[model samples]
Target: MKHYPVGVFCDFDGTISKSDLIASIAYEFAGQAGRDLVRRIQRRELSVREGVEAIFRAIPSARLPEITSYTEQLTVVREGFDQLVSGCIQRGWLFAVVSGGLDIFVHPVVQAYRSEIEVFCNHLDASGEYLSIEWDVTCDDLCDGGCGLCKPTVLRRFKPDNDVQVVIGDGVTDLKAAKEADYVFARDSLLRVCREQGIACTPFESLAEVIPTLEQEVSL
Candidate 1:
């Protein structure tokens, strides 16, 4: 087997968890307004940053603790996540969860592997009466997506020279990262977009299926 360095940048929400926690929490807390914002995001009527900001802005700051608690209880990491993280560490591969999700909930959900893999995401602020987002990362000139955490920027910064850039994701948030990847593991909307754009990719429904495929790629 050939020895090569690999960088795996995976999405958080829908890809890691069984569902999109952002949307789930939005609808649960923000109600119809949250649903509208999410719909606008899907239709490209609003940027992901804009939509997410509006969604959270609807909820009171006091609800943050409750929200965090609910999110932790509700989140379920995808199968093979730990295995994948372990494999990467063992193989000297870089595995990071680069998400458009918030730090509050994202951190709690991935707390088990907090010391293992790197996580890049946005922060949630409850300083005022209503919650707001604090974007610690943003899109560079090369991108126009207005992604809150800017996955592409994270990918570019972390992707090492001569390393295979692999991206795993399942939504619009992953689109720019896919364009930057040498290998892509896609599903759902991201899969459809990949097909439409003619971007070469491997479609996967779960992370379990991704493990063998990724291992084989790096070995080759």
Candidate 2:
């Protein structure tokens, strides 16, 4: 068997969790306004940053805690996430969550793997009555839809020069990041784009399937 140094960067919302927490927050907290903002984003009419900001900003700042709690309670992270994280560590592979989403909700969901998974995402200012992103990691010009933090840039910064880069994601925000990877595992909207663009990829429905595939790729 052949071995390659591996670095895995995964999208947070739909890939790791059964549902997109941002959409949950927007629709649950922001109500009709959130629905509208999400619709625009889905249609590619709004930049991700613009749509995300508008969605959260529509909600009262006081609900930040409520949103966080709700996300944790309602979101179901795919099965085998624990084993996948353990498997990566056992193989000495780097693992990270590179999300185009906010930390307000992501923190609660992914905190369980804080020791093993490095998380890179945007922080939101919920101190006011509405939510707006505070970009700690800025998006690059390659991003046309305003992903506040470009996942590809984050991947480049963390992945070693000699290591093989792998990306797993499920949405439009993941497009640039998935393209930068040497091995791609895509699903949902991201999967559709990868197919259309002729990008080499593996499609999966759950994290349970991802581990074996990664091991297979690393073997040769």
Model 1: per-residue lDDT, tens digit, 1-220? 2233888889989898877989998889999999999999988899899899999989999999898888888888888777778887787777789988888777877788788677988888999999998886788887876786898888777665426889999997788899999899999999999999999899987676766897776553
Stretches off by above 4 angstroms in model 1 are 1-4, 217-220
For model 2, what is the error of residue 198's alpha carbon versus the real structure, in angstroms, after optimal superposition?
Answer: 1.2
Cα RMSDs of all predictions?
2.8, 3.1
Candidate 2: deviation at residue 59, Å?
A: 1.2
- TM-score each candidate: 0.93, 0.90
lDDT of each prediction vs. the true structure?
Answer: 0.84, 0.79
Residue pairs of candidate 1 with colliding backbone atoms: none
Question: What digit string (tens of lDDT, one per residue) describes model 2 on residues 1-220?
Answer: 2233788788888988878988888888888988999889888889887888788667777777887778768778887677777778787777788887777667777787788668888887877767677875676565553775778778767655426888989998888888888899899999998999998899988677777987776553
- Looking at model 2, residue 109 earns an lDDT score of 72
Error of 1 at 50 (Å): 0.8
- Candidate 2: segments with Cα more than 4 A from true spot: 1-4, 141-145, 218-220
Model 1 score (lDDT)? 0.84
Error of 2 at 168 (Å): 0.5
